[model samples]
Target: MSYRSWCLALGLCLINGPLLAIERAWPITEGMDVVGELSHAEAAYEDTLIDVARRHQVGFEAIRRANPEVNTWIPGEGTRILLPHKFILPDARRQDIVVNLPEMRLYYFPRDESRVMSYPVSIGRMDWGTPVGTLDVIEKRENPSWTPPDSVRKAYAERGEELPRVVPPGPDNPMGDYAIRLSRPSYLIHGTNWSTGIGMRSTHGCIRMDNDDIGELYSRVSLGTSVNIVNQPIKVGWRKGLLYLEAHPPLEELEDDAKGMDEAVAKVMDAVGERDARVDWSRVRSALNEVSGVPQVVGWEADQPLTTSTSATSSARAEPPAADP
Candidate 1:
């Protein structure tokens, strides 16, 4: 049967939501069809991307995939992201949507749900920040229009080039070929004129998925599907008897915050009183430097340093974007 026909046969259409727990590395089974989870939310923060992911217990890749449109290095102030803390696998015949804010990525759980596929994304920028709230897919379009927002028009007007109200869909169109309008006006899940900006922060206030990925998602989801937007900054886990932390601070935390990143790392270490712990200072420092917010750990640690693990029981899974020093 054809793809659409198959969907019709099952009466199962994919949907999006505001925030829902995401499944981790779930085992792919033949009979199980997993959709996005139904329970998860992002935290409010003004820190950088790395610090935000660390605090939220999610992977950097997951974050990147959820917010594909964000700039990786310079996310502006008050930018929010989705944190997948739990997994909601489908049961043999369902589909779901997953967005990880820190990594700025999105994953689509297909109807058959044999396996999950992820795509790079872009999210809100400094002034034209995206909102964090519950949303639904209200409409989907092919060859969508690129109506320039008034703010964008004003920007152009200042430059002596007054632009038209809309740009037609094509190579020059910012919306690319497909657009999924959200319940939130002026916001959408659409294609991009800027592709490298995928997996980074670069949009005014929309969830920018990859050209192909958005197309795949657009085809699967119907109007009125849920869409959840959020912001989280930290993700932690235990690996090999070590406590690992991954962080992505919000942009606001970097612009005006007075506390130095080095000092912040030292402070967190001091708080644990594990001064002698074998913490990777370089990793901590880089996260603070590159991500523009707080720092988080990506490996295990104790109040006291211990010998390296000798058994697999102590093994821990590293976050996808774990910075290697």
Candidate 2:
């Protein structure tokens, strides 16, 4: 949809009123979570930032934030881009919530001693990228109500379709079955009538998850917990003395400029603060450049080799031995 249309339709969801306030997202941590090797430089044809990130398992936001110079339309061929592949796991401390922008995923870690559970989520579009800052879940409601903001209602009225001031819970309700209020005024992590949008950039600014996923998360998380939103993909891991790396593409919206293998590797390493981990820069560069999805160990001592595993679920788990660096 056009930017104007989006603004009109979802303006209420972005209202800035003095109501329940959710905490802002946290800052990016300079840690690593060992993904796998980076490829060397590669070329792109008919590539969008989102597709490139998906191909490389990176978040669109991380790739976009990393390379601000590359335009979305003309990310020239052999551009030698870096990918945020292996990244440090987000700091989901007590009541600390984390959102990995690159992976398009949200994780809820309870404050006390509750085991954390994560779910895939679709965030805002580039025009309305989800805001990042320290935030918290402020309120919760079952069978909640949705009150379309004034701006949204005005826009619709201009279109000759005046909508209701408030919507009750039902299948047609945009807020879905359950809603968790945020500290950021009107924003929320709630269910959606558009379940397909989960894991895709379709929301205005709120985080969207599958109905089941949200339900599961709702049961586990409570109000007053911390929420952290980040965009690190390529994470570095150190097992014993071996430095390991994993490279994935950014999220859908941030992959528009994903080219230049050397630069991409450097960006990923920089995200994790492990530029010195590259034993063979050339090999690492090549892997970042490669377009294939297969995992590869670009550089390491011949005897002190590294093991790599690539799977969405494997990476999602609390710990996976196969991914040890």
Candidate 3:
């Protein structure tokens, strides 16, 4: 089948209402690394990309990249905003919480181990990159105050602005209402009243989530919960008999270290392991080129008829360009 046809077969269709985002816990299957379904909805008159993103539990960059034709500031009425809700699970331990920096997304696996919850997040910018590794949640705080670090205060000072020594819990406090403190005091996976940064690299070495998401997660987690953050831009996984590849634009600083097709091809090889399958190199390259963060089929079992994956840009339901990003 053609790539577009495969997506239709996969039923990466439209969805509506409060039923979006990480509120849905995807069922986990043994070796089934792909989860969630691709969805897009028409923008209401007052909607901007970020507004639509927040409503659908998607990040700014993810939504923008997926719908390059839509306006970021004002996607005029009826414009279809593609929500990159589908994901290729990061290659990390599937327990506790896992934050994938490149995609600016987090996956939480509760003790039940039968399903996973996904959320969009904002990570530290290039200079103060969020470090990777396994860390445990050491504490939880509600209505936390924000004490500007010297570096942060110095930044405001250099810009000829004054920052109060401490910002009390309130709307102005960017720390949001709840914070999941990590083993290291310097780090936190916290909620943010500032939803603008939820899906971008715009933090000070901390992980930020939508206020609502973190609020719910806070109650579900306790001290000593393991949190593993990884930076995997290219993820490969299997579903049924096909091999899928999902790519995200690599962190700017790490782009120079990437080997392009060679790296992606190798990752597929590692994932395929001893299993017999045939891969479509061209499709793999196309997926890499788009860096959609939405998984697409790249291979199938050697004995099964191959269905080439197409980097479907949702052009069939093309939303007219309204504003530029």
- lDDT per residue (tens digit) for residues 166-245 in model 1: 88878988888789898877999998765534555678878886566677778888877766554444333333344333
Q: What is candidate 3's lDDT per residue for 1-325, written digit by digit as tens? A: 9653454355332222353434458999898988888877888765566767877778888988888778776688898777787888888878899998889999999986789998889999998889888999998999999898899899889999999999999998888999888987889988886675578888888999888889889999988999998878899998777778988898988778666677787788888787766666767778899987778787666666533342333311111122324
What TM-score, over all chains together, does every model reach?
Answer: 0.52, 0.56, 0.86
Please give the CA lDDT of all the candidate structures: 0.53, 0.55, 0.80
Q: Give the candidates in order of TM-score, highest first.
A: 3, 2, 1
In model 2, the runs with Cα more than 4 Å from the true position are: 1-88, 91-95, 112-116, 154-161, 238-325
Q: Provide the lDDT at 240 for model 3.
A: 77
Q: Could you tell which candidate, 1 or 3, scores higher by TM-score? A: 3
Q: Identify the candidate with maximal lDDT.
A: 3
Is candidate 1 or 3 superior in lDDT? 3
- Give the Å error, residue 185, model 1: 1.9
Q: Write the per-residue lDDT of candidate 2 for residues 1-325, one digit (tens) a residue.
A: 8653464355211212222221212222233233223443333654444444434434445455445566544466667566643333443343457886655767665554434444557787776678767778899888888898786678679999978999988988887888887899667888888653455677767887666667877887777877777765444344333444444565556666444454445543543353333344444444455423223344333344345522111121111122214
TM-score for candidate 2: 0.56
